[model samples]
Target: MVQFHKGFPLELGPVEAFRPNDIQHAAADFPELNFGIHHMGDPYVDETISIASRFDNIFLILPLWFNQYYLQPYKMLHRLGDALLFVGAERICYGSEAFIWPHVQTYIDTLATLQMPDELQDKWGYPEITREMRENILGKVFARGLGIDIEAKKRELAAA
Candidate 1:
């Protein structure tokens, strides 16, 4: 579990915690290892994205942001859209948040029905969120990253 961001109480420390800058060195030093940044460095989303743009091995995980998505639907959707547009579906993954299972269901449902609005598409060149792209983000990409042959594994299990 990668804990890039924290909800640390800000009473004692003068400096902010969970800065993505702190993790940049490790990512730069270890190019072979893949990094799934939790919370996408929350409170520093843009910085995380900037760093991820530089490293191909960096992947963005989306489930932890469910609360933020519930609170700010459009803002979260746009942020996700930006990530999908910039990083491509191959570098994003989705899963349950454990605490908010129903919210996650809504999140998935929302994503399933997602479409790039015409104005946003024309203005920003954001691609339409096809079912295949969604599937890749949901699990296929992570399975590929882990070197898992999902279909073969399924067949093997079925044969057992």
Candidate 2:
């Protein structure tokens, strides 16, 4: 797996690197390789989703976008909804950067209680957050993607 911060454009400050539309060529060029787009390309969520949706090998790591939960949680919910609706749970992963780990519980808490508004579901057809979906984003999806046996890991950790 290869991952990059989409890091570029200093004028944009610390939000994100804008859009990731230009990544298609490399993704197409390397069909057998997997690409994890960090930050979910922030304001370019649609673009990120478009790329991820088009390529089975493309995935999203959510540490940056997930930080919005500490500032504007509603926006995070919509983004989460969009990711789930467009790419589904399997491609979404909660990436806790080292700095983010200290406050990771907040992200976990917000996601734990995250729910799409009823009108949103009626209007946008976004799926309501379910326990199974929540669990996947928490780490299950990443573990499964890496071919890790979760039950075995749990036992191993317990024994430790």
Candidate 3:
């Protein structure tokens, strides 16, 4: 999985920033590998989304992006819409970026309260984020990317 942090090119400087072309080449060359771009490519969200749309193996990790946008509920709705419209919910995953933020509960609470605006719902043709989709983003999707069978793991834990 690819973890890119070039979204803040201006702050990090052009030299440190991740280039979209690099991602394109990697995705094209390694079609069989799952590519996960962290921070959702931050300031380059649109470009990341565009790149992800082209490669089925590409996934956007919602770590810093979630914390950054969750407070602004409207922006969250639009961001979610763009992701859903382009790559679908299955191609996205939630990331805590724990230790760095060090406040897991705050992030959890924020996500718990997130609500998609009615206008965005109408625009995206969905009433709201469903429980299944939420589960997928929070864990199932990432588990799948890593070739982990979450259901089987659950069964094993239950049997134990």
Candidate 4:
């Protein structure tokens, strides 16, 4: 589990193929492993959040795809927001999953445009969410979750 988690890169898509039982086994084998679940586990945000909360080894990375705006009628973002709260921001990281530099900028702008309630914003450790939170979402939770001890990793990355 540690080898897999250490070796796996963020470019990989949502970990839908990984079952909870597999996670449980991995956690049992390596309690210190950091397993990042992406996009709220693709189509199962609630279950993904639940799994994150249930297992200390599980953490979440909020990757950009369809912004909160594209969730349609707001149901999708609302469900995602609710689930995100359940998992708490400290356990959540951020990513754009952008294919290029321009797409990365678009993701930054999109995140800035997202309107979040005060309570949620506070939980996210920001007065209000902006593209700035991207850094925190990228490295903060991940650093703490994995307890990444390498000084080099810490120097190269920022923590929440």
Index of the highest-TM-score prediction = 3
What does the lDDT read for residue 100 in candidate 1?
Answer: 50
**Candidate 4 residue lDDT tens string, 43-129:** 555666676777777766665434555556255456546655576666666532433445565655655566666665556533444
Q: Can you tell me which runs of candidate 3 are displaced by over 4 Å?
A: 9-11, 123-127
lDDT of 3 by residue, 21-138 (tens): 4687788898888878876676677888898899998887887667656467677667777887788889888753442756777876665566667877777664467777778787
Stretch of 10 with least lDDT, candidate 4? 1-10
What's the lDDT for candidate 2?
0.76
Task: Tell me which of candidates 2 and 4 scores higher on lDDT.
Answer: 2
lDDT, candidates in the order shown? 0.70, 0.76, 0.73, 0.55
lDDT digits (tens) for residues 1-160 of candidate 2: 5675763344747544356876777789998777778778866777888889998778788875677776876677777778889998888887535233577666678777878888778888889888988898888867765657999999999999
For candidate 4, the lDDT comes to 0.55
Give the Cα error of residue 95 in candidate 3, in Å.
Answer: 2.3
Prediction-by-prediction clash tally: 0, 0, 0, 2
Error of 2 at 82 (Å): 1.5
Report RMSD (Å) for each prediction in the order shown: 2.9, 3.3, 2.6, 7.1
What's the C-alpha lDDT at position 63 in model 4? 58
Score residue 116 of candidate 2 by CA lDDT. 81
lDDT at 33, model 4: 71
